[model samples]
Target: MKSLTLDQLKALAQQTSSPSISIFLPTHRAGQDTQQDPIRFKNLLRDAEKQLLGSGMGPREASTLLQPAQALLDDPGFWNHQQDGLAVFMAVDDFHYHQLPFSVEELLIISQAYYVKPVLPLFTNNGHYYILALSQDEVRLFEGTRYAVGQIDLPEKTPVSMEAALRLDDKQKQLQVHTGTSQSGAGHGMFHGQGPGEEENKVLIEQYLNLVDTGLKEIFREQQAPLVLAGVDYLLPIYHKVSEYANIMKEGITGSPEHLRPEELQEQAWPIVESYFQQETKNAVEQYQQFVSTEQATDKVGKIVAAAFNGRVDKLLLSVDAQVWGNFNPETEKVTQNADRQSKQSNLALLDFAAMKTLQNGGAVYTLPQDEMPTDSPVAAVFRY
Candidate 1:
C-alpha cells in the first residue's frame, strides 16, 4: 500500500460527503455462565446510558439510539443470544450538537480509520521532459497521444559532433534523431576543415533516424506511435526540420533533450504525472460529492455496510493506515468491537471493517494513506445506494 501525502488528502476531503449515521461500539466480554444475569444486563445498559448521556445526548435520544437492543433486553432468550456483547450506537443529525455523544477515543479511532493512499507517477528518461496520464491513481510514461520506447546512453560524456536526420516507413510513421560523433567537426566545420564533414554529419543523422524508424515500424507495424526527439536541445530543432517532410505527427516531438539518466528523469517526472491525475480525481470527487449531498447517494457507513452485506456495493474507500480491531461475523456481515480486551485485534478498527465488508460483497476496495484521505470527511466508505 502506498502512503499518501497531505496534499492528496486535502483534495479528497473536498469531495467526500457526510454520512447519515455514525455508530461507536465499546468492547465486551462473555462470562462462563450459560445464562445471562438479569441484574448484570440492566447494570450494563445503565452504564452505557450514562456514557451516552455524558456525551451530550438527552435521555430520549440516547434511548432511541440504543433501541435496537430492546429486543434482547425484553426477551430473555435474546439476552444470551450472542456469546457476550457491549456496544453503543449514535445517529448523526438526530441529536443536536450539544446533545451529541462523542469521546476522545472515538475521535482518535475515526481519524486513524480514514487515511488515504497515494498514486505513483510516470516520468521520461530525459530530465527536461515529462508526461501525465489520465488515471488519478495510475500513471503511464506517455501522455496525450505520445508513448515512450526505450532510451540509450553514450560511452562518452560529450559527442565530438552533432547532426540531425529523418526517415519514413511503409506505414508512413516518421522517425528522427539527432546523432553525435566522437570526431570534432567531422560532419561540419572543424580545425581540419578537410574531411567530408558536412556529408559525414548528414549520413550519421540519416542512419540514426533510419534505425529508429525501422525499429518503430517493426514494433507498431499497422499503427503509429508518436515520434520523440531526445538528445541535445540544439539538435531537436534540426531533427524536426528534417522530419518535417515526412507524414510525422507534429505533437510527438519532445521540446528538448534529456539531461539526466533514465532513473533520475523518472523520479523528476512523477510530480507532473501526479498533478495531472490530481486534477482528474478532484473532478470526479466533486461530482460524487454533489450527487451524495443532494441525497441521491447514500453516504452512511452503516447503510453502506448493510448494502455491502446484500452484495450491492460498487466501490469501497478506506485509509491504508486505518486499523480495525473487532469481532466480525463473516456469515452475517456484522461487526462488533471487543471492548473487553486490551489487545489490538479485538479493538475492531473501522477502516478494516470497511475493507472486509467491501471484499465480502465483491466490491473493489481502495485504501488511501492518512495524508491522501479527504480533508473534509476522512471517514472510509462503501459506495453504493
Candidate 2:
C-alpha cells in the first residue's frame, strides 16, 4: 500500500465528520491465543453502540462509551495483555490529536513503523546522521546504540584538538563521521600574549580540511553513496571543500541540529534525507514528460489523431476533464464522430482511443487532473518516426 502523506491525512479528516481509527493486532501466537474472532469483534462493537444509546448518549459518543470494552481487553491483571503482546487502537481527531493506545511497546512499534518509511523533512541537516545501515528506510542514532556497524575510530588531532573519523560499511551501505571539538589551548592565552593569532586560525582551518578530506575519501572508496553533510554552519564549509575533491551526487546542510544528543540528531535527519530522494524521483518523471512533448508529431490534436489512425502514436497525454468521442480509419487518415456498420464500427471512447493507439504503437499514456494538466489542449500524442 502507498504511504499516506500529511496533506492526504488532512484532506481525509476534512471529508469525514468523524475521526479515523487504526487498529493493530499482534500476529505472534501469544497474542493470537486470546484474540477475538471477527464475528465477536463486530458484535462487541454493536453492543457498545447500543449501550451508548441506552445511556442517552449520541452515536458520536460511541467510542467514549466503548472505553470499558477496550479497557477490559487491555487489563493486565485480567489478561496480561502487555506480557502477551498487546494490540493498539487509535482515533485521529486532527493532525495533532491523533491518540494511540496506552502501551509503550505498541507506541514504540508505531513510531518505528512510521520512521521506517521514507519521509521528507524540510529543515534537515544531512543523511549521514539520519539514514541507517543496510536499510534504505531506517534511521541511525547514537543514544539508542544504533551506530553504523563498522564505525571507525577517529582519534583527536592535537593541533586542532578535534576528534574526527569516518565509518564505512559497504554491506550496510552507510558512511558517517563522528566529530567533536576539545577546548582550545589558547582560551586564556590572551593574558600571556599567547592567544591564537592569525597563524593559529590558519592551523585550525588546515586541520579541519584534513579531517573532511579523510572522511570523504573513505566514503568514496567504500560505498559511493550520496553525501550528507550535517552539523553547525561553521562545519559546513569543510564539507564544501571536501566536495570539491569528491564525486558527490547530492548534498545539503541544515541550519539547526535540534537534539544535541546523537540519537536525537539521527531521528531528526531521517526525513530530510527521504525528502531529497523524493525530489529526485519527481525530476525523473518530469524528464520523461519532456521527452514525450519533444517527440510529438504536431502541436494540434488533429495531427495527433492522424498519427494515431496510422498506429504511429508512441505516447499520449490528456487532460482529466477532456471529453472526446471519435473513430478513425488508419488507411484513409479520416476521423468520424459517429460510424455506421458500413464503416468499420469502432467502440473506442476518446480517452481509450488515445491510450490504445499509444500502447499498440509501443508507447505509454499519462492522464493528469485538469488543474495539473500541462496544457489546455484536449489531447496530445507522441509518434514514432
Candidate 3:
C-alpha cells in the first residue's frame, strides 16, 4: 500500500479540465462491518452519478467517469483489509485512493477542484512518521500516519539483512564498532548468545548495528520525523547505542519483526507517537496564543489566505468543522467570501486553499477542532512577515 504523500496531494490539488469527485468514508478492519465498507462506497458512487447527471452529463459519460471507483465494489480482496477510513479522488484522467489511519465523516464533494481538507490531518507537522523494522535477516522501513503504515523501498546501499552484512570478508574488518554513543528494528536473536561467549556476541551485534546505522544515514538526513524501531528486547538497546538518527522513539516494538506485516508494526507504533504529536500540538497552540495580540499572528481569513500564497505563513491552523466559501484573487491579494457554502462548484473552500498554500510554501498545516482554535475564527495563521 502506498502512503499518502505530499507530492500525491499536490497532484490532486491541481485544477483539472473536468469536475473532480472527492469521497470519504469510515472503514472497518474486520468483523461484519468489513462487508459494509464496499456497500457504503457504492452508495457514495451512486450519489456522485446522480450529481453528475444533474450537472448535464450524459448517462454513458457519467458511468465512464465513475467506472474506476465502481470496479472496487466487486474486489472483495480490496475491502478485506482496510484502515480507519478511506479517501478517494476521481477526475476524468486521474483516480487515487488512500487508506486513512483515522476515521472520517462520510462526505462527498463534487467540486471544480479536489476537496483536500478531509485528509490534511495526515500531512501536518510531525504528522508523518517512520518505522524501521530490524531482524537478523532484513531491514524494513515503513512510512506511516496515525493509523496506517505502508512499507517503503529502502535505498540500495542500506543493508537488508544483518547476516548478509556480516557475511562480508572475514579477513577484512567490516566496520569499526563504536561504543557509548546513544540512538535506537525486527530484533531476532541470531546474535543473542545462549550457547557461546556472550561478550563476542555483543561485539558482533554492535558492529552490525553500526553498519546498519551508517547505511541509514542518508535516509535520516532528509527526515526530522520520529522513528520507531521494532525488534527483540536486547537488540533494541544496542540500536539505541549506535543510532545517529535524531528522533528515535524510546519505546520500541519487541519480538522479531521478520514475520510481522506493516499493519502490525503500525498497531504497536501509534500509541508511542500519539503522545509526541499531542504535546507538539499543545506547544504550537501555546505559541499561537502568545502571539495572538501581536501583529505576527491573526485569525483573519483574508490576511491568512494572502500570506499563505505569498510564502509568509509559517504555521496554519484550520477548523476541521468549518469551511469559508470564497474566492481569492492572488494577483490583487483580495479575498471575497460567502457566509455559507455556495451552490456553484467553482467556489473555493478558502480554508483548504490557505492550507494548501501554506504547505506549498514550506509551512506547516494542522487541523484543530473548532473549540480548540485560539480565536473564534475558522482559520488562523502565524506569519513570517
Which of candidates 1 and 3 reaches a greater lDDT? Answer: 3
Q: Model 1, stretches more than 4 Å misplaced?
A: 1-263, 293-299, 305-317, 337-378, 382-385
Q: Best candidate, lDDT-wise?
A: 3
The digit string of per-residue lDDT tens for model 2 on 1-385 reads: 0122233332332332222232332222235544443234345456545644664667767666345445554543433222212332333232221111111122111110111111111011122222211111111112111221112222223112232221213421222222333354111111112344445533444455555455434223322223444444444555465445442324433433433344344455445455654454344345445665575444355567677656777556555455445555657877665321121243324443454444444454445445654455656655676
State TM-scores per candidate. 0.31, 0.28, 0.77
Model-by-model lDDT, in order?
0.36, 0.37, 0.79
Q: What TM-score quantifies how close candidate 3 is to the native fold? A: 0.77
Please rank every candidate by lDDT, starting with the best.
Answer: 3, 2, 1
What's the distance in Å from true for residue 183, model 3?
Answer: 22
Deviation (Å) of 243 in candidate 2: 3.5
